[model samples]
Target: MATVKVTDLAHQDAQKMLSIINNQMPQLINQLNSTGQQMSDPNNWDGPLAQKFRGEVWPQAKADLEKMKNSLAQLQQSVQKILTNISHAGGA
Candidate 1:
């Protein structure tokens, strides 16, 4: 049989990381939105490139940023899972 071991320190570290990520995600998303807004501003771009990037690239980048929440949630869930059974094994 195979076994996996997790520790209290690991749980604490995971919790810390999850907390940090949760806190930072909003700021990151805001920055992404700011960038997208800047890209869409006509003053920032003066050529056909604006039609290409603001119309296509910036929009896609913003969409991807929206999807990042789910990915971060999955990471938090994985860490929580590792911390789950650890409590029964003298872990926090």
Candidate 2:
């Protein structure tokens, strides 16, 4: 079989990674907003469900948001690296 170049693989991976990140961004934003709202509401803080909801669920949601943000940042960096690689390969 044929050997594939690193540049070609990087570009393809970058595109796919960008697509996945873009698709997840809206859902992540919605979750972050919902969690923020819940945390901000005084009633939610004092409620019976607050122990589980706020302590566990909200914290997990916040962690998910952080993970999503980090993933997106990494994906952006990967795309930038791919573009740089492509440009340098073309100029050489």
Candidate 3:
């Protein structure tokens, strides 16, 4: 079995990150849509249950979405850095 070089590993990591980002985007969109729908329903504001559910669930969901977004952004940056390093290494 051949040992993979660091550059090969980095390239694979970048592809994996891109795949994760692509998968998460649709989930993020769905979350946004669901949140919007929940807010748009007039009855959602009329009851204690709704208030409690929103208070407990919405913030967590928002936080999760933010976390995922940040993670995706960081992964993208890392991928870009890896690609740049690979290019520079090849040129050198």
Per-residue lDDT for 3-39 in model 1, tens only? 7677767879877887767788778888878978887
Looking at candidate 3, the ten consecutive residues that score lowest on lDDT are 83-92
Q: Which of the numbered candidates is closest to the native, going by highest lDDT?
A: 1
Q: Candidate 2 clashing pairs?
A: none
Please give, for residues 4-59, the per-residue lDDT of candidate 2 as tens digits.
Answer: 35556666776677666777676867777786767757675767676667677777
Give each model a TM-score: 0.71, 0.52, 0.55
Which is the winner by TM-score between candidate 2 and candidate 3? 3
lDDT of 3 at 58: 66
| lDDT of candidate 3 over 1-92, digit per residue (tens) | 85434566666766677777767675866779587557746576647766765677666776777787777778778777776776666621
Weakest ten-residue segment in model 2 by summed lDDT: 2-11
Model 2 residue-pair collision total: 0
lDDT (0 to 1) per candidate: 0.79, 0.69, 0.68
Maximum-TM-score candidate = 1
Worst 10 residues of 1 by lDDT: 81-90
